[model samples]
Target: MSHKQALIIYNPLSGKRKKHSAFPILLNKLSEIGYHLTVNEINEVNNMNNPIRKACTQKWDAIFIAGGDGTVNQTIQFLAEEEFRPNIGVFPFGTSNEFAKFMRVPNNIIDVVSVIESGCITPVDLGKFGNRYFINIAAAGWLADITYETPPFLKSKFGELAYCLYFFKKLLFKKPSDNISINISDTVFSDLSLFLIMNGNSVGPLERLIDEKICDDGYFHLLTYKKTTRIKLLFHLFAKLLNLSKDLSIIQHTKINEADFMLPESISLNLDGELASVNSSYFQVLPQHLNVFGSNKNN
Candidate 1:
């Protein structure tokens, strides 16, 4: 069999322990699996974009990204425009590697490489926010902006806990938002506090949002929180996150192909753990848009 060629696009700033992590082991494993690896650290975001643009110009059996959700989203944004998209494998080194986790990519770096070498290329759906394409999840409203608001130092210091702590603190001081409205075709959601559009299953720490398999479905999932008191929203959200809020069902969720939003005021969109500033925009799913190198997802 011919040897495979792989390109690993990494953003070192995506995680704190990345340098000390099992990254080298994974690279060694890739080499042993009869593959040639081209490793590149992103010195600048724009600098990396050009190489990715050029990557599709050649033949790469697989592309590994050593970053978190935002990096994945940025990569997808570029690949979506290309006529060819290689099977994507991720190191999940970013703050909220929700998409990677949902795909059941092993947290152990060695195991992650094994999954990629297993050659399970699963084609999955993609989401579009206005003109930008996102590989994982996107959201707007109250809790969505937390990552953007939290300081990088705090995130580096506290890791995932920082997000939870910051969210709790922000809820206490921030003013309640005005009732927002969303309309997708004939479907309408009014007095909403949060809007989430997902091409994958998990969102931050909330993985059980969908009990059904998510990927390869050719539809994006939508979750909107109803207008409610701050305490109640917090209680319900925490409960849901902990799998204790089944009876309380605080969200209105569905699988949709596309939707249009109408917001009374502007709330920045969070695209895969990064901020996307948009007051209102059309959202849609690009069915089976990209091939991913991971196990298939079950809802």
Candidate 2:
């Protein structure tokens, strides 16, 4: 029998304190499961000879990603362009690691290796907005700016809390305003403070952003917050986050297979957790498009 070939692309700077310790454990366990492993440590972003690019040149049975959402998104962009894509195994070793959290991938290296060895794979959905693909979320409006606006230094030092601090800073000082239009299922939302199209319920540290379990459903969860006062919106958001409120009337949500948005040139769209360069306003969900190593219970 031919051994299954696997490639590991990991960001050297991610989860610095834990990654070094986890590295050897990851290699030994996967090898035990009959995978011939080739490892690549990422030192810089956009290196033409990056591991993701290298993985594309060969027929890898699986690709293990060890980083945050931004790193995952970069990999998705490259893989989506190929006709034959390998299954994904995620190691949550970066700030927030929202995508891995959504996958219910355990943070412990030992357990993560077990999941891969279990051979349980889930067919997951991916969202295509303009030219890029996202597995977790595609968002825009009010607070979405925090994704890119927070300095890298802050993210590196404080992790997800840096985004929270920046959020409140913008909330107290900047008025919540946006000129955008969303059309889904023939319904139009012309005025929205913020909007998110989520494949999973978790975003940043708020685990139940949608208050329900989201899975590989064929549709995206479209959550749109109507225009409202900054202070009022903040309180309501907190209420929802804390599970104090089951429903917020100002926030309209529904399941959608596709949607279109008219965004201002000044407004930046956040894909996963990074800034998205999208020219087209159209967005569509490709159901069960990718196979990921995750348990079905996570859904």
Candidate 3:
């Protein structure tokens, strides 16, 4: 077989720096499979508005990202707009790893290396928020802030627990829910507490939060939680997470290709674990926007 070229983009701060150990192993494995590799630390490179965009601007056979959802989110932002984008390989080293989990990419580095060798690629849809693209979710409301505000030191020490700690603390002193308006295909939803534009089945610890079958369905799901008390909203979220009941009338869900939102200045959307603040935003689904390496089960 002919050799192929690939790029490896990683974040030093994600997932307790596990990538530092797995990277050399990945290098060996890729070399064994005849892949010529180029490596860039996402945080270290300062040129071209960060290395992810600069590296992705070139053509290659594949690009492997060894970081958490935030790193992958940055990489996709550039690749989504490129015509000669390479196939994506994600080594899920971040907290939650929601996009990789939704894509069914293996959690361990060993399995990911094998998947890369197998050459299974799946086309996946992405949610475009304004000029940005998110692979897993775009969220707004009280809970969204936890993803970005949690200190990096806490995440390094506690991993997922860091998010949980911040969550409970915020829940106790939670502010009033924003009275937001969203228009999706002529339907308007107002007075929503939590707004989630989901492209995948999981968000943070909540898995299969949306139908697993519709993950790549060319349209994104807009879920609005009615403005309710924080305790009640938590109950509704857990109920949905457990699939505990069918009478989830408190939550409104719709699938659409595009939507418009009017949000409060205080509320910002969390796109794949990163913060994006906007008073008004437009969201659209780019169907099958990127190709990623994953098991056949995901396809």
Candidate 4:
């Protein structure tokens, strides 16, 4: 078969300076591998989706994104809605490229490019919230509020540490509100503190905190927490910090293909890494919605 044409969508702000410098070398290696490559930088808001849609119209074989989870989410949203969906690839340039971890893509630029040119494809499930798409995790309540309140500068300097710092800050001041209700696979639960819907095993490379969650399982692992004492909350936080999911008594995990949340107050929702405030939200799993290009043997 002829080598597939690839469109690379990248976020220039992702990663450190050293990783950014290696982009040219990666492009050169891809060119030598008999694949036609087109690269575009995601500079402004909503810039990533336009090029991907245009590439689909041009009949490209695959769309390779070289950013963090948020960029990958944007690309998937476009592909999932398009008439012709192309294969996908992730270069893992962002701070926490969780999808890349699921696909087993190496952080090294050369290895990532080689994996893409190898022409392997895996059909992966995607989670949809309203009109957008997320491939890693969707969270709401206190966690989402903290994510939105965290400063960009802190994230740039400390990466995942920003999340940790913000988590403590929110927990100290924010009271657990029982204003939310969740319906998962027809089972309904009311008066919840927080809810995390995961497409992957872990949220990021923070394996110690997020646990070992798999992405290709065709269903979402939903974790919900009820209002509890401060001491219990502290213990649960420590358990997550140590990757001890079983010890965290405050958390409840269930698997479902679809879920909806009704909240009395406006709650912030984090889809992948992007944050938005919504009063109510619905999430559904779209199995095999994306064709991912990577080095996994099963694919």
Pick the lDDT winner. 2
Identify the leading candidate in terms of TM-score.
3
Q: lDDT for every model?
A: 0.75, 0.80, 0.79, 0.72
What tens digits encode model 4's per-residue C-alpha lDDT throughout 1-299? Answer: 36668888878777544567877877787778766887877654264458778877887887778788777776776677777778887887776677788778888888877777677777788888776788878887655566546776776788768778888887788776555688876788876777878866555545524444555667978877766776676578557656665753577778878888886656667787777544347778888777887743334
The C-alpha local distance difference test score for the whole of candidate 2 amounts to 0.80
Pairs that collide, model 4: 201-213
Q: Superpose all Cα atoms of candidate 4 onto the true structure and report the RMSD in Å to 1 decimal.
A: 3.2
lDDT tens digits, residue span 106-139, model 2: 8898899889888889889889998889988888
TM-score of each: 0.89, 0.90, 0.92, 0.86
Residue 13 alpha-carbon offset, candidate 4, angstroms? 1.2
> What shift in Å separates residue 172 of candidate 1 from its native position after superposition?
0.9
Screening candidate 2 with a backbone cut-off below 3 angstroms (N, C-alpha, C), the clashing residue pairs are: none
Best first by TM-score, ranked: 3, 2, 1, 4
Q: How close is candidate 1 to the true structure, as a TM-score?
A: 0.89
lDDT tens digits, residue span 1-299, model 1: 46787878787777566443667777888898877888777654454356666667785777788887777877776778888777889887877678788677877788887887778788888888788787777777777788778877776777788888998788878755667677777978888888778766567776666776677677878877887888888777667667676653457778888888776555667788887765348887888888887865553
Query: Positional deviation of 279 in candidate 3, in angstroms?
Result: 8.8
TM-score of 4: 0.86
> 3 or 4: which has the higher lDDT?
3
Alpha-carbon lDDT of model 1: 0.75
